[model samples]
Target: MNKNKKVIEVKNLKKYFNVGPGLTLKAVDDLNFYIYEGETLGLVGESGCGKSTTGRTMIRLYDATAGEVLFEGKDVHKMSRAEHKDFTRHAQMIFQDPYASLNPRMTVGDIIGEGIDIHRIMGGKERMERIYNLLETVGLNREHASRFPHEFSGGQRQRIGIARALAIEPKFIVCDEPISALDVSIQAQVVNLLIELQRDMKLTYLFIAHDLSMVKHISDRVAVMYLGTMVELASSTELYDKPLHPYTQALLSAIPIPDPNIERSRQRVLLEGDVPSPINPSAGCRFKGRCRYAKDVCHQQMPELREVGPDHFVACHIV
Candidate 1:
């Protein structure tokens, strides 16, 4: 956790789906980023902008149409059976929906111990002990292990999901909007638990969420995506203070400030036009339609992400 090591690296990652005989939907296109060991990299964008899809693709939930995902310097998609099993053991996911992700039929202990049994980590008393320990680790108790998922509240269900992900002792986890489905009162509790767990366990995370404020609170580095492509990436503090991309600026402007006077004085960047379709997208910049400062070049050529400031990268012709 103290060392600066990369846990995951993505290079020119593209995931496309064929909707019809001639139409193709680009869910993730040429995305390039890396997550350091013990650090949280936040991926934020509007819905359907491929935030969740990117997380799923990185974890091999969906096959890539092109490009490579390197987990600990090994290609995730190209791994053999043994390597894939090892990768699965080291990497786990906490899905967005707590209610849907957990199996209704299985007991809490069985659900949490499923990975332990699949990998044959332990059995009998030892395995039962492990399940009980996992439950306690996520703020639950052994008593809850005998119950089903329907018996728990939304926040408790998410905690159970967290326990399930940690059962195998994974190094990297894709937290795909883990707290999005929780009640507003319970959201902070879950986020705080995740933060504490990361500090205690020395875990790395790819936190994907549309909640920019929450992302800033948890992530070290933030990557902003728009229309299946990365628009900007920088340290959380730097990106929040000085965003370079139009989409990013608009997104930040939408966050409500606490002070009434300051909020009223602040200028909101209201974007014009609807988001362009990702299906068979045009040859130019995907954000050009909504960007007021877009020029002729933005319509003719797609912008590639370029380093603008120290550790700050942005993909925009004007920037």
Candidate 2:
């Protein structure tokens, strides 16, 4: 996994949106993590947990409200014009919705080659050849290059989005729920393709999604987020086998098992309360409101994410 080489490092990152008068939405708050070179770090959480926001802010798609995102030891938000351009070429994003992400007017070839042209990487026959190669690499053909996004199915459209991201030959990619919009049957296909591409291209990924099972399949490590705060982080196997935080435990318990007997015998950890709003949130653990083991301290102080076991971290007082 090349743990010694960090492809991306996020430190105390925050992204807040001012929604109305005297109101701010903390989309991503106090995030801290790192993506190793040539490894996938899966980010799993419920909707509106800031998983996408974290990915976006890390890549500088949205400017941070606080803290830094270091890309190969360089602060991403502090880069110069030329450096930002180079960063764009080195890092790319694959949006969640294939239908909305791709330009409807542009053909597959043009969409994939846009980055190449913008970066002036190549032109003429070589450019066309690269486009053709990318198309074939993503399981499309040269003939499909002339077709618009509407001509392809959902999965096929996503493959095109992948090709577009790959066209720049990026070292890191923010896969913002890239397979969420696809059919259940097709989701695995897309994830498998991503795994294959990462291995072949030597790419690192921050793969954000709500599907824990899929995340486990594709990720070396997984981080669990709740109310824009990280509750737990660990190796995929470790997190699934022995989750420490209450929120993480509840989240892992919800993943249905294939065996009927095991599923029937297992007890689900049902969270009682609704998730608290992130707008000017209280000074305490975000999950304490719903946590069964919440103590007096949990309501007063936000527990920092601490390493308890080998490569396993959790943010909870009871842990």
Instruction: Output the lDDT of residue 217, model 1.
Output: 98
lDDT of 1 by residue, 1-319 (tens): 5447899999999999999999999999999999999999999999999999999999999999999999999999999999999999999999999999999999999999999999999999999999999999889989999999999999999999999999999999999999999998899999999999999999999999999999999999999999999999999999999999999999999999989999989899998877788999999899988999999999999999999999999999999
Instruction: At residue 207, give the lDDT of candidate 1.
Output: 95
In order, what lDDT does every prediction score?
A: 0.95, 0.94
Clashing pairs in 2: none
lDDT of 2 by residue, 1-319 (tens): 7979999999999999999998999998898999899999999999989999999999898999999999999999999999999999999999999999999999899999999999999999999999999999998889998899999999999999999999999999999999999999999889999999999999999999999999999999999999899999999999999998888889989999999999999999998967788898888888878988989999899999899999999989998
lDDT score at residue 137, model 2, on the 0-100 scale: 93
Displacement of residue 191 (Cα, Å) in model 1 is: 0.7
Best by lDDT: 1
Give candidates' CA RMSD values in order.
Answer: 0.9, 0.8
